[model samples]
Target: MVEFGALPLFLCVMGLFSESLCFVTLEVEVGDNVTIWCRHELIVSGYIHWFKHTCGSAPLIIGCKQFFGSVPSQNCFFFNESERMVVSVQGENTSLTITAVNVSDTGLYYCSSTDLMRITFHETNYLRVKGSESRRQSESAGF
Candidate 1:
């Protein structure tokens, strides 16, 4: 008893109700290690993308993972060539870890997925990396 023309609209409404977004703010000190975690729900065959955006800079794809059938998950970093950054996927959970985090790492990290229909943003993490004591003291003293 559903009108053909309204079926799309109904589905859109249902999707809106079923979708959820999570945001987290994190702070760390320089030389510290940090990890951002993301969980995907109801995704069977698709890809998860991790992006980073900083003030006055365009968003960049940092890492990605693909899942298809019985194939194992593959992880790669497009923007980060350094070994200090790593991306790993285990079941429905994925994490991006940064070693010896510094001020340049401060930015917004986003976790999104694509199912060939639309891109769904799952989480946003705002990372603030503070300098060490000596560095902070020197900068404040203008040394």
Candidate 2:
């Protein structure tokens, strides 16, 4: 007979090495354009979700359901008005593009995908925006 007590432990161990979302940290200057890519290999029906996480605050949903399909069926909805934010998805590749990125856009961004089987994969990328010397100095001076 199979030991049911050890099944949960076995699954937990497997989950640790599950496939992870693929992305990289990005550093760009103000007004620069950048794209973050998220990739998954699972062949299950799923939806992709993007979020921006700021310090000491809840994550803000930047986009969702980024996939290749009809516009209404696979559309990205931005919680805030951001003319710079654009998202595109094709098969296993989902990318978020930011045009003319500003200082306020610097933060941690996450890309998550969940399939019908309830298996989820997610990755976080840190975006750093460089500012002018004056602005940096002012920030350092507590301004």
Candidate 3:
């Protein structure tokens, strides 16, 4: 005999929460390159920036940073010098790539999109130094 109530109960026991959209990795050797990818949205057109808000206050510009010169500098953070970050408004991807990953580069990073009118969608991603390959392999095996 089959039980209908049991199936629903089984599913309830499993934790299902937020939906993941993009595939990104922070794999870089001590002297290698690292890229951070995130799903982008069309709502962000004119203004695009990458902020390393370790505590999620606000976002800031990346390269050629002018510290509240023309960009919105709502929060301050401790950033690394060697970190390479890039945002693509065309590809709907706020992916960042860093060369020569160092211990100082590890922190909580957020990819945010904005327009001159309002801020759009943003997703938080972490930068770690190791085991991304194993994690990817494990996810594949599970399916």
Error of 2 at 109 (Å): 0.8
lDDT of 1 by residue, 1-143 (tens): 45443344234334442222323678898999999998754257788777787756767888887766356676543343348777777777778899998788887787666676666665567787877764786699998
- Residue pairs in clash, model 3: 34-98, 36-96
Model 2 is weakest, by summed lDDT over 10 consecutive residues, at 13-22
**Cα lDDT computed for each candidate against the true fold:** 0.69, 0.65, 0.46
- The TM-score measured for candidate 3 stands at 0.48
TM-score list, all predictions: 0.69, 0.66, 0.48
Cα lDDT, model 2, residue 142:
100
lDDT head-to-head 2 vs 3, winner? 2
Candidate 3 Cα errors over 4 Å, as ranges: 1-28, 55-60, 63-83, 88-90, 130-143
| Best TM-score among the predictions, by candidate number | 1
Residue 39 lDDT, candidate 2, scale 0-100: 72
Instruction: Summing lDDT over every window of 10 consecutive residues in candidate 3, give the lowest-scoring window.
Output: 15-24
Per-residue error (Å), model 3, residue 130: 5.7
How do the residues 2-97 of candidate 2 rate in per-residue lDDT, one tens digit apiece? 234324323433444222322356889888999988775435455677778766677787877644343332664544435678766776777789
Every model: Cα RMSD to truth: 8.8, 8.0, 12.0
